[model samples]
Every structure is written in structure tokens, then in C-alpha cells.
Target: MKQRCVKPRFWVVLVGTLGLAVGCGKAPSPRFDSNLMVMDKYDISFEQQQDIANALAALFGTPDDPYVPKESGLDKDKIKLAAGPTKSDKAGVHTGLYREHCAHCHGISGNGMGPTAAFLKPYPRDYREGWFKFKSTERAEMPTNADLERILRHGIPGTSMPAFEVALVQPEIEALVEYVKYLSLRGMVEIELARQTSEELGEGERLPTTAEFLVEGVLKPQAEKWSSAETKLMPVAAPPADFGSPASIAAGKSLFYDVNKANCLKCHGTTALGDGVLNDYDQWNKDVAEFRTKADATLASLTEQRGKAEEDFATAVEALGADSALSEEERKQQRETLEKDKAATLKKLGEKERMLPTAMAYTLVPRYIEPRNLRMGVYRGGRRPLDVYYRIHSGINGTPMPAIANLVADSELPADLSEEEKAQRRQSLQTQRMWNIVDYVLSLPYEPGGELGADISMLGRERN
Candidate 1:
């Protein structure tokens, strides 16, 4: 051909290859399109994707560090099998490593959350957070190795943390443990520094120690121990225990609604409905919350008001139709022709969140907490009903977890505590009842068999 546009052909190859790489076009350029193979979209490599998936899978695993040298005694770099810590510098190095590795979701100091924050729920702890919510062996504190291990071994089911027992080796797990303790210790130290650095009563005055992050009690051992590179992580103690008994459960039931125990009826109401069907402890308050000042709300009210709105919308739509008042038959014909045009004018009202909606999430009564129907003892949290029992016992932080720590009489219970001695015995029984009730509560959400509820794991229990 007559000097076949060699110049154009040369430029086509160069432009196709270089244009996508240099971002010469505007934003939303067709660079990501498979047609443009010059560069990879999202700048992510295949390896990185695998890593990200691995990282996500790890989250759903045990929430605790997996490595605590079993009787076999573990050390990776040194490979020495020993029960106690070998090197002290290793402790400090491990501490620093935790800040880089574990702190994000677990907290800047292993409190649960470092940088990958905001994207998680059951939100990361403050580290300076409380301990011993349920099935706790320690009076109250961050879990011992035993507690942490169970969480790590099984991984809280529904949560993002996953089990790592398979992917991570036992020795690496030990390294992680040392690292976590270091973070906890480091966090404790940071709190101390913050206090010491605070502009207190005077510039020179040292910040007095409260409970932790101080010289005396909490951080002292940590500091001394870390200095020696004491890699010895304390063993986590087993904390699980059984629910009280039938009598204790009955006692707990009384306290659940009664004034003596927690006096929950004030907010929860008599029938367990936020509605005060049994009595009026909070008549005005309930009215204020559920109150909607709009002109029409009830279905009866909607039945009255539907005509005008639909009629007006239909009138406008009829602009495209041959006849106006949209007869039933004609409307059905038009509906078949249009999809998005429907629901264009109907104004719907959704329940407004509380003035302090998030706050109310904590204060809500147990009835509103929304129990998932359980097919078996295994909850999304884990296999143990005791887990929920612990949650109930300790009460979830920051909200209305309803601390049944102290049992009381139900508002529904006969108000007849005539004898003080009887009351004391009842209180004792109520305490027991609290534990039983929790078990019963945990046992709930199981499928109901006839009038009786059956375990969902036994759903096939139905003879039919």
C-alpha cells in the first residue's frame, strides 16, 4: 500500500502502552477497563490480595493470642523448649513489635484497635478498659492466658476475628503472647506518662498514682519484669462455671421485675413490653418517647388519608394517559407498563431514633434486645450457653445490659415479704435464681415445641 501510515502505527503502540501508565487522561479514565492492559487497576498485586484475605480470616479466629508455650515449651528463633522466658531483650523487642502488628484492631496498645479503626463493631476496647465481664476467674482484670487462649483458640464466631490455630504455629503464637502483654504493659505506661505530663496542681508536682500506669502497683512489676526481658507470660486461668439452679432461677425471676433486686420494672414495664400494660410507672415518659405529633399515623388514619396523595400522583401520571381518574382496570394496565414510577409520591414515616439513640442502645430493656432464635447451645458468639450467661452476669459495658448481679423480686411477684428473715432467705434464693434465670435466658430463642420451647438443634424434634 502507498507508504502504509507507518507513523500512525508507531504512535498507536506507544500511546496505548504509555497513556494508561502516565494517567494522561482525566479522572475516571478507562484505565481500569480490561481493554486497557497497560497497568493494573487498584494497584494491588495477587500476593497482596491473598495477604488481605489471610488477614481478614485471622480476625474471625480466637480473639486472644494463640501462643503460650504448652508443656512442650516454645521458642522460635532460639528453638529452646523451656517453661519460662529465656531472654529479656526479646520481651522489649516483642513489645515494640506488638505496637506495629497487633495494636491496630486491638487498640494502639493492645486495647483492641490500632489504625484499622472505625470499620469494626463491638468496637475495640480502650485497653484502659474494664475486665471480667463473664466467666472470669480473676476478680476483675484483663483475662489471664487461659481466658485469652480460649478466645483465641475458638475465635468468637460472628466477629471478624477468626481461628488461627491452623495457619499460625505454636511458637509464633508465643511471640504474639509476649507482644500482647508488652502492649498492655506499654499502654499502662502511656497512661502513666500522660498523667505525669499533665499540668497538675503545679508544674513540678508529680502526677500521683491512682490505680495503674504508676510506680507502685500496676506497672511496677511490668517495668521491672520487662527490663529483665521476662518473656514469661502468666497462664490464663479457666473461668467457666455452671448456672445456679431451679430455685436460684426462680429467685432471679422475682428480682428481674421486682424493686428489691434491680427494680427493672421502672423502665422495662410490667408486661415486658415497653408498653405499660400492667401498671403506669412511666406513663408520661412512655408517651413522650412514642409520641408522634403528625396529623395521621394510625392505619385507620392512613385509610382516611390515602386517597388524596395517590389521587394527586395519579393525576400527574395521567398526563401521559388517555383518561384521568385512573380506573382500577386502567391503573393495573399502567402499572404493568411502569416500574419506577410507582411509590414516587407516597410519604412514609419511619420511627425516629431516641434523642440519644446510641445511648438508648445501652438502656434498652432486655425484651427489646432482640434474641436470636437458637437452634442449639452454640451461639454466633461461641458454643457455650455460659458465654451468654457471662455476658448477662457481667452485663455488656456502656449500655443497659441489666446487671442481674443482685437478684430481686419480679414486679409480678406477690408483694408479700412479711418476714425480714424470709426476705433474707428469699434474697439468697434470688441470687441463686439470678444464675438459673440467666441459664434459662440463654436456653431461650430455642424453637418452641408445642407450648414448651425446644432447642433449635432439635428442630426435627417436631414429629410432624
Candidate 2:
């Protein structure tokens, strides 16, 4: 089995420091800017872009000086603690926690386009989208504060995000969490404003930048979602008496391969090794795949044009060399002129290429999300039975893994049953099915060598 690679914390800190130093020596303190990609997607004009920036500044102040609105339900004190340049008081209380620890990978704007982002396989989270993978809440709901805090403390397995439990105190963790929420809220509002300006307003009409309009129309809705995340938590019921028994495991295996049931084999593979379908991308990559495709095509076209221009310049130079009728000085001047024109053409093409999305742009190149290799016994979310149950219950948000549903179809139930009774029966069966799958998943690591060894030997024989 191949071992998963995890970067050491010291290396992360070292690389992050070097990455951030590349952007140093700028005189002005950095400030959050409007997401240009979002604006471009909506075709927002420069004038409207300025208006959106102003509104965002008014709501959430600059990086050095943040302003969290009371309506946002964010802690102003915590935001202050996490914002600004990295420093500590004489007493050793840390300030600018996010910049010091997170900004190198997550970016100061929380857009996940920091200096070192491109080097990572799975890029850092862009807080702007508000879609989190591991959470206790339902798919459509925001993650609870506890959910975010747990990730911060334990970190994620097999990812660049490191555990901060021993490094920082609990209060520091809380401050970073609040600051993340602030960035997420600010980004969500910016996206909403861009959508309204592009889709709802007239061609020449400007977006309303008033606090009342923004708070009432845009900010409140997103804030309420964050505020109510805990209430939307998916409840996990206790497992049955024979939860991890052999009988339960056998039932889970049966369900795993059943076409109309869990059907886990489809993506997880016949051996529960993640070697099935390899083409699916997660929601984040899917969101920008179309834009990336268009950008790539434009880049290819420009590259071809540049190649032709170079060839043409070479041909013109050759023709000039053969002009025996011209004086030496005239030939030299003409060659210089030709060189200037070629330089100008190349410069224009370079500018257009730079304007398109690159490695450091808002969105990274789309990557296929690999399903979990259960044989390795590594669960990115968590390893506990409850954690596995939550995964099977609500599904990992923003991934292809779907929530367990429709276990007991209406037609399968008694025809004379009331609507509520049918719904109750469906819920009961779905809950049991989820637990069964959870049991099977947890048992994979301890399965007899005969079962797993046979699969591996068979694969080797076929390859030979």
C-alpha cells in the first residue's frame, strides 16, 4: 500500500514565510479588493466595481483595520485580534493570527490564491464560496462554530492544513475562526452585489451601495444562515445493539454491492479501494471549469499568433539581408524598425495573456477529487463511528458523495398508510441503512487477509 504524504509543520511555516516575503517591501498596507473574477463573470463595469468596493469597505474595513457589523454576528474583538500585521504584545499575546499563520496559503482575502497556493495539490479553502466539506450540519447549511473550531484544533488528515491545537491557545483559535467568518460574510456579500448589478440592473444603472440596502437585502440573509447553522445540525441516532457484529458487517457488505442500495462499489471500487470513476471534480473545481476552459483556449490562440509573428519577423529580416540596393546605414535603420515592431507585437500579446487567469489567479486549475481509499483506513473527515455515520447521513458537502436517502420508497410501503406514516417509515429505514454502511466502512481495516489478499493476488496475476 502507498503511504499518504503529509507536509511537516516546520516546512509549511518555512515555505509560507518565503512565499510571503516575495510580496514584501510594498510601502502601503494591504487592503481587501473586490473579487475581479466574480465581477468579470457578471460583466460588471469599472464604475460599478468601484461602488461595490466602497460598499465592502464600509461594511468590512481594510485588512489593517477591520470593521465587523453588529448585524453580522461576528465578534469585533476577535476580528481585531486576528487582523493586521503579525505581532505580539510585550506579554506575548499574539495579534494578526490569520496573517501570520493562514494568509500564505488561504490569502489575506481568504480567496485561496496566496503565493504558495499553486504548489499545493488540493488548494486551500476559498472562504468566499461558503461551501465546506467536513461539517456536522446538512449539505445546504453553513458549518457550526464548533465544526470550524474542531478543524482548526485537529487539522485535516493528508492535507496542507495543520493542527493548531498545541501551537496556539484556545482563544487564538477562536479569534481565527471569527475572522474566517468575517471574510466569508464579506465575500458572500460581494458575490451577491455582483449578481444583482449584472443581472437585475439596467445596462447603465449602478448598484445601490447604501448600508440599508446592503444589510437588508444582501448581508442579512447570509448572516442569518451562519447564525442558524447549529440549529440545522443533522442529528445522529445511537447505533443498534448489534452495530459492529459480524451479522451487521455482512449486511453492510451486501448493501455495498447492491445496485439499488448504497452502491458504494460504483465509486469506491469492487475492493473498496478508490480506483473506480476518475473523472469527477468537486463543486469548487466544477464551478470554474468552464471559465478555465475558455481562458485556456484564448491562451492557446495567442500562443499560436505569437509563433506566427516570430516566423514572419524572421522572414522579413532575411528579405532585408538580401536587399543589396539599400545603403548599409539604411538597412541598419530598417532592421531596427522591424525589431521594434516585433517587440511591440510580442508585448501586446503578453499583456493579453497576463490578463487571463494564471496560476496566481482567483481560481486554480480544476482537479479531480479522489474518492477515499477505504483499504488505507484513512478518513479525511474523522474515524469515529459517529463521524462515519454523519458522513453517510448528510454526505460530505461539495463532493460527489450523496446523502443516504430513499431507502424505503413510497411504493414499497403499504398502500393504505397515511402520508406521515410513509414518511416515518422511510426515515427509519434510511437511518438503519446509514448505520449499516458505517459499520462496513469501519470494518474494512480489520477484514481478513484472505478477502483483501485474494483481490490483490488476482490483480497481480491479470497484470502479469
The top-ranked prediction according to lDDT is 2
What are the per-residue Cα lDDT tens digits for candidate 2 across 85-146?
A: 99989998789999999999999889887888989867888889788878899987899989
Q: Please, what are the lDDT tens digits per residue for candidate 1 over residues 356-462?
A: 22223212121122222332343443556456545555544333444454554455345675567667666655545545556554433342454233322243332
What is the number of backbone collisions in each predicted candidate, taken in the order shown?
Answer: 48, 0
TM-scores vs. true structure, each candidate: 0.41, 0.79
Error of 1 at 113 (Å): 3.8
Off by over 4 Å in 2: 1-26, 297-360, 409-419, 452-454, 457-464
> Candidate 2 deviates by what RMSD?
11.5
Error at 86, model 1, angstroms: 20
lDDT of 2 at 196: 87
Candidate 2 pairs with clashing backbones:
none
Model 2 TM: 0.79
Displacement of the residue 241 alpha carbon in candidate 1, Å: 14
Least lDDT summed over 10 consecutive residues: which range in candidate 2? 9-18
